[model samples]
Target chain A: MSIASHALWVACLGLPALAADRIEGPGLGSPVSAQSVAARNTSIYPDGRGLPEGRGSAGDGRLVYQQKCASCHGERGEGGSGGHLVGRGPLTGSDADKAVGNYWPSATTLFAFTRRAMPMDAPGSLSADDTYAVTAFLLYLNGIVGADEALDARSLPAVRMPNRDGFVWIDAVQPEKPR
Target chain B: MPPVNPSCRAIARCVQSGGAVRAFSVVLDCADTMISPDTQREHSAAVAAQEALSMERWSRSRLNADDQAPVAGGGLLDRRLFLKRGLVFSGAGALAWSSGAAGADQAALPSLRVPGRGFSNYGQPSEQEKRAIRWISANRAVPGNGVSWSPLHALEGIITPSGLHFERHHNGVPDIRIDAHRLLIHGMVERALTFSLADLARYPMRSQMLFVECGGNSNSGWNKEPLQSRAGYLHGLASCSEWAGVPLAVVLDEAGIDPAAKWLIAEGADAAAIHISIPLKKAMDDCMLALYQNGERIRPENGYPLRLIVPGWEGILSIKWLQRLEVAAEPVMARNETAKYTELLPSGKSRMFTFVMDAKSVITSPSPGDTLRSHGLYEVRGLAWSGRGRIRRVDVSADAGKTWAPAQLQEPVLPMCFTRFRIPWNWRGETAVLKSRAIDESGYVQPERDKLVAERGRNGYFHYNAIAAWQVDEDGEVTHVYR
Candidate 1:
């Protein structure tokens, strides 16, 4: 059978009218409609490519961060059960805790990761505005931006990370160069 | 009803070939003809001669510390001699049964005269084999965040039985209802697409026998002192299995990947929302959207319905319960790539996206917690593997690093899969240190513990592929040691 027709037949099996195929549907996973793609496209890129159109300040982000993120990531972002968000220590050479303020390379990644997966218990549950505000709050906690500074797609990508140039992409397949 | 016995089936087929009476007569005549005097005498004589020959071989093969014939160019015995007795290397290899030819040792045990339990739709390892289990190590504060180690030393073959495969979790395994699970392929694409588990199953599929090793495997090796736990508990983060699924390349091609897309940010559906950035080259090269593991629908902990199996890559990159693939020009630089899984090199610079595992081997049989038990003639067996390619050779050093002897690699040493290697050793009661080093197909040799430490420095905590050493004491106790 053609691939397109096969995809449709497989999807049609999920419908109720297909009485004989109902039991077999469990073995075959439920079909995903084409419309489902729009909702699932939630990842944000390093260049602020997939960020949703929204804006928020550190003041607004504080309430969202406390209500959602604070329990896992400590009250002051000092790291309790989750990762520490605010640390000025070195990123490498010594065993310094890699926190967002020092280790992260991109600020847009903060919004993308938190929006898609955050609060640890409930992921993709925060509103777009809440995600932007939380990203601003985390930046403020890290002393990268002011507490009252507003952030959106344009501003979040412009913020620089402390260890932006620390990472070096060494080829995993290559042997250690004769140092 | 009990499953049909092969012997009974054979008898039934014989009866069908001829009438029951004729079959009975044929059996009697065959037995009578075989027992005839002349034939009996000749058979007995031939048996006697064969037994004598085997007896001579038995005496020669018998364990004797002083009487071993030296191998050419080495003090150790010829490696071929180790395969003479029960070292059958087919499908899981031989069990090393130290008994008479007819298994007289087991004959002493009573047989069950009555019928036992009936068969079930599903099966489990015999209750007597309860020792094979994943040893769990979790964060006390967050029970969800933890890892369960596969009991590698207890298992026999290359394939890690699904139940005992190692598990690494950021947030505990989510009970995903397969019907609700959807995979999204978006970002730099001509057409963003969503596929259900059923849709993926309809696509063309492929199976590969490969190992998924956690990047942090052998992390204990980075410790200043050697860990004293069993082999599996220390370095069992890796497990091999036959993963069958649709190729991610086909899925991405269907979604129409943009020319500019160089990275794919794959994310899992777990509460932790664990995601990692995979290079497009690796994804298009040999990545699979895995649906079944070991010929069955994957278990919940293993990301049932769908997972990404990037052969020879770190385990985290092969995301479990994969939900989304965001094609992008650059990596996501997510917390996983930045905060964790990255290595701190001695040059004070950090190494990111170090995916492939290095060549390494460990003597699991003689590892810590396994007693030597007055070892006379023992098959020193272990596992060796390399991510670059197939294993070329494995060398065992009995006196620490003083001398080295080659071990026999089991047949079908596929790339990135576990290669079981065995060498026969005669252990007198004297104390000795044991080590095994592996060389991959690419001519890369596994470095010694000291050499690896000197190069990577103490700041390193991941990708420790140094040769592991075990110390055998005079009292027959085996312990982990850095020789």
Candidate 2:
């Protein structure tokens, strides 16, 4: 018999075949508690969804940036060891020159990335306020906002990135879509 | 697996130390003693002739016309004489040394007297093959965030040994206890569910040979100058293995994905908590929660208990130490997808989520760091692959791109897996350049270096899949060059 027909025959014999059209057999696992997901699943999307209530100004952020990020990102955010936080145009350049100011396409990414993973050494340690402060400081260094401008859940999403419209969602274009 | 015998180790050492002829002769002599006199007489003359042929001086440049004959396809070599095909064992012609001394005086060999040790629970490559290891390039400052390259040039066959599979870890590999680990599926799902490793194992499974390649693989090609390194080091960030797992779609269906869930935000348990957004369609199609690789439990460095395997997608999207997958309406804009992996297109705009790796091929043997010992005939062997689909053809050029020759594709060239292609070429002491370009089933040709550079520019350094060229000096030294 042909392989396809043999597979069909096997399926008919009540024997488990390789990959089913849909799920078969008893569904595995148990329902998870909503609290557990709420506690750990802390990811923020681009449209300001899942953001916590907090506020910080660029001036207030300078202190946090100095204490927590300066060691790696440089005191002035010019970048010493870790990636640069300030630069302009041509996101592609020397490793030190591809700063957040130039390359990053979304401002919300800064707040999300900072809140989730930042400080290089002690990630997930920053408070929501501290994360906002750092995000404001980075934006200030990029000249995206004034030093006194306050950034919060309502204000952060409105910040425009220099390269915000520069990106191309490659999945939607060119070569015939995924089969 | 049983303990490997010390004698077996000794035999391996003997074979590895250019004493294969002597070791094989001793083994044959021992066999001769056990066989009856009539049988020995029947094979004695044939064995003697084989031994004589083995001891005969041979040149690397010499090739039998019958074996090197060109086939019907453009520049394609005859497939009958492929060294990897139709492996057969003959008594007299035993221990075939494809191209090496066959016979030597076998007087002193310890393995002849001592019986080897028993097997062990797990096996390892013989001590002599220790050279086959992942070339690690980790950061001294960060320690764990780095990459290890698979030694592709040293390996044979299409399947890369699980131990030697390339690695690109963001945070040091997490020591996740299988029993303690639980994968949480929540967010836009109708029901939030957490499954233990055992629970996932209860589901139906499928195994397929697929390749996982880091998005940054072959970035060295973007360097202003071509890098001089082994073929594996330059492009070894990709590896192929047989992964066995439960289709992710089934698990998602169990969770009942919300129609609004357009993306799946996968997070790892690593210190970095590396997370990225994968399209919901891709997740529901052909993606799997891989629990095993190469017929065994996945290696610790390669996502121990569970990993999300998105076939043909960037390796990073195949998150290791998978902890939670949150269905979302859009991308998380994670650091990996923004500051890194994203490319700065020459159009002055950045390109994000350029997920699929394009068609590419590399001549593994006679590559940089390999020297042509003699001017005789050599089989130009290499691997060709395309994230889009199976490689339809791999055209190899011996004298740069002036002329092209088709290579014989090995059987079972599955989609998105490494297809070993080879063509025999005769070198006559001339300084020749070698190149191979892969054409996938979609008719997408691997771009040339100049064409790629002209389009992408040298400022960006990701997803570089241009044709690689190796130059052979008159003295037989091979090195990398951007032609």
Candidate 3:
């Protein structure tokens, strides 16, 4: 018997055959709850979409930074074992210290990064308010924000960074090089 | 996983006391030995001669007349040599067997004198091969935050043993429990969903042999001076494996992906919680939630329970220890993408999200730190790969691109996987500069170091895929050079 004819016969006989035009896959995933996703959905977007309700000033952040992030990041964010969080330098030079104010194009990144992966040894341990406070302190250290400015979900993303227009996306239309 | 005693500082070291460096001495205990004193010297010499002669002759005879002829200036044999035709092994084997019989003492080894050691549940490499290891280059204060390079110089063929696969960890490796782990595919979808390991197994699964290379794999190549280290340390931040898992598109399709979701914010569960942004278009094309490596469960360091295998892209795109994948419209512009992975050009503008690894090749056999032993005839072996596609050709030059030779591409050279290439060369004790350039199916050629550096500028450290040059000194030592 021909393979196609055999498959047809098998289908006529009510035997299961591979579906050719079926686009939707074998649904196996279980629907996740809001509470469960909230626990893992710590992704903070560039437009400050995932920022939670939190408020802190540089003064509030100084205590949090010294207590939790100082051992590795040094006393004043000048950097030690951890990378320098303060100071701005040329991106092309040998000593391009990619501190908070100089390199990062978005202010929301500081909150997201610090909230998700800061303190080196202990990550995601800081409270939302503490994380916002630390973000403010680091921004202040890099001269992006004032020492007493209270940063929250509303005001954090609004703060313009020094190197906001520093980065350029891949321009494919331009002439190609060896890179 | 088999126990790898990596803590041993000095591997393959012999205990030398009172000027005695011999491994096996003439044993007076004849009752426990296989050979007696009278014929020991004769037996030893005969054995050595028979073994060496047979090997040289047998290897030489395997080649047909067409294979014997050199295709290029460096005595490069035809790539067709790999596709050996006709029944020629018996003739060579007969000759080898007769020669060995003449020196009958060449038969049994000391190991065959007694029963061998029992089997292991998971077998490790021979104790004598302990020299092979991933060379760790971690920071003193933060050991786990650095990379341990795969010892590509000490290995052969294509597939890097899973244990020795290169590791580039932003933070330390996280100990994730299989039962507790969940892959949440949420955000910008019609219905948010999370799949457990068991749930994922029910979906259609397939495996592909792909390479995962760090964007910073050859970052050192950006330096003014070529690094003087093993070929692995210089370019070992990449690794290949038969990654088996469900297609990522299947899961996304089940979740009913939103049309506006153009990006994926992949976050790992490690201490770094490494947040990375990948294009949604690429994710749907050929990404996989890799559950297995080399037919076994993935190693903990290489992302055990679940990881994304972004084919033909940088290793960082393949998020290890994956926890949450948030579908979105824009990139997260995380630390890695902004502060680190971005390249600073001469124009003072930094280039971001440059993903594809370009075509590149390195002669692994006679690479740096390898001393070409007598150097009459040698197989110039190396690995060539292109993240864009399969390598179309790899031309080797022994005299600094003055003369070129085509190498035999080992069979089953899959796309985005390491394609092993080899060519026979006759080195007449002359100082030579060795070079290998890869041309991918996409027609992308590996650029020279000078051309690459000149175009990339001094500060662009990531995505370096330049042709590697190895200088063969007259003394038989090989070192890296920028030619």
- Alpha-carbon error at B61 in model 3, in Å? 11
> Model 2, A77-153: lDDT tens per residue?
75433445778766543432356787787788888878776765777899989898889988998889999999888
What would the per-residue lDDT of candidate 1 be over residues B1-483, giving only the tens digit for each residue?
A: 311112222323333333221111122212222223443344334322322211122123435434565442223455676546754332211223334454664655445455678989999989766556676654434555667778787776689999889888887788888897888887788777778887777777878899999988887677655655668867898999999988777778777789977888898988878888888988887788999999999988898878999888888998999998888777767777866677777665678888889998988876677665544555677899888989999998878878888888988799999999887776666787888999999999999999998888765566889999988888767778999
List candidate 2 stretches off by more than 4 Å.
A1-19, A91-97, A173-179, B1-62, B65-102
TM, every model: 0.79, 0.83, 0.83
Candidate achieving higher lDDT, 1 or 3: 3
Whole-model lDDT values for every prediction = 0.72, 0.74, 0.74
lDDT tens digits, residue span B1-483, model 3: 322222111111111111111111101111012222323334333322322211243233333333366666555556655455762434644565566653576556666687888978998898767557776644334556667777777778889889989988867889999988889988899888988888887777889998889887866676556655668767898888899998888888888889977888888888888878888988887899999999999999999899999998888889999878889877877878877777877666778888888888888877776666553556788999999999999999988887788888887899999999987676667898889999999999899888887787756667889889999899877877888
**DockQ score of the complex predicted as candidate 3:** 0.28
lDDT of candidate 2 over B294-362, digit per residue (tens): 999999999999999988888889999999999977777887887777777666776779889898888
Docking class of 2: acceptable
Clash count per candidate: 0, 11, 0
Fnat of all models, as shown: 0.39, 0.52, 0.55
iRMSD of all candidate structures: 19.7, 12.2, 10.9
Q: Which model is ahead, 1 or 2, in terms of TM-score?
A: 2
Model 3, A65-138: lDDT tens digits are: 99998776678886544555776777665534456777788888888888888766777799999999999999
